[model samples]
Target: MEEVSLGTGNWDRLTGPVREMFVAHARTWLDEQSDPSWALLDLDRLSACTMPVLLSRGSTSPSWFSMVLERLAAALPRAQRKLFEGLGPIPHVTHPQQYTAVLTEFTRPAEAGEPAPGR
Candidate 1:
């Protein structure tokens, strides 16, 4: 985990305590990993939800993550996606104010007939 973190530029950006915490949590998750039951996820049932969904992703995340995000957006009825330019995998940790601003703006009620941001 340490080597991967350093290789991915996360070690340089993260504080010592934060890195340690992340490593500990990652180890725990790895230890807890098991075969996930794919049958539990009913995509047809999920697609029935009509509420607006906001899907945000950092620009520097793994390519596969972006593909998953695309798939999730397509599966949902009213999903809006926003790619945070120049941000790393965890944008809220790296750019808290910008992340908060985007979230706040997106959650605000839109004016009549006006499309929401990122729509």
Candidate 2:
């Protein structure tokens, strides 16, 4: 948990329920470590998806996460990517208002029959 806090840099900012959720799912997180399926990426299938996709990551997140998001954006036909500057892995927990605003902006275009941001 300490490692997670250090890695995310906002674990302590999470609400009690949110923190509890992570704690409750600790076993699932551990199990995912050895899950081979987790490593699989069916880009073809992803590309076939027609729905709008929002790919987000915090600026402070590890570079690998940005790489993964870039790959997804390339694979998805209508993918929009957003970087939350000054935040870490769990941006929603650390900065809910900003996260919510981002989400709202992303959906607003869709609601008005327009393309998502960055599309």
Candidate 3:
């Protein structure tokens, strides 16, 4: 298996020890996985959320994941979608700064008594 995240970004900036640590963690996480109950997902439960939601996906992610994201975004009452072009499955790991900036912008509090943006 690859020792690093796919696509370009600051993943190259990781030190040898840090990279090894991530690899170890990835191994542990992978070793602990069981078959997911994808069919049991409750799409209707998504409608219960009152907070603003931001749904994102990398352009290169698998079709099934993207389809799920599209459905979840559509089900939510207040949700915004963002597509990260030229990234891989884990955009946050590959593009931390950009991800953090977008997350901060989306989650920032609204001005006094004013409606939040992107709702």
Name the best candidate (by TM-score).
2
lDDT (C-alpha) at residue 66 in model 2: 76
Would you list the clashing residue pairs of candidate 3?
none
The lDDT values for all models are 0.68, 0.77, 0.70
Weakest ten-residue segment in model 3 by summed lDDT: 1-10
Candidate ordering by lDDT (highest first): 2, 3, 1
Best by lDDT: 2
Tens-digit lDDT track of model 2 for 26-92: 9997788568776567899999988888888887787657777888999999898898887786667
For residues 3-119, what per-residue lDDT tens digits would candidate 1 score against the true structure?
332225655677788777886798665654443542244567768878788888777676645766777787889888888876665766667788899889887768886666545
Backbone clashes in model 2, listed as residue pairs: none
Please write out the lDDT profile of model 3 over residues 1-119, one tens digit for every residue. 23233444445755578678777798665654444755345778988877778888777665666777877887788888888887765667667798899898786767776566545
Model 3 whole-model lDDT (C-alpha atoms): 0.70
TM-score ranking from best to worst? 2, 1, 3
Model 2: weakest 10-residue lDDT segment is: 1-10
**What is the Å distance of residue 89 in model 3 from its true position?**
2.1
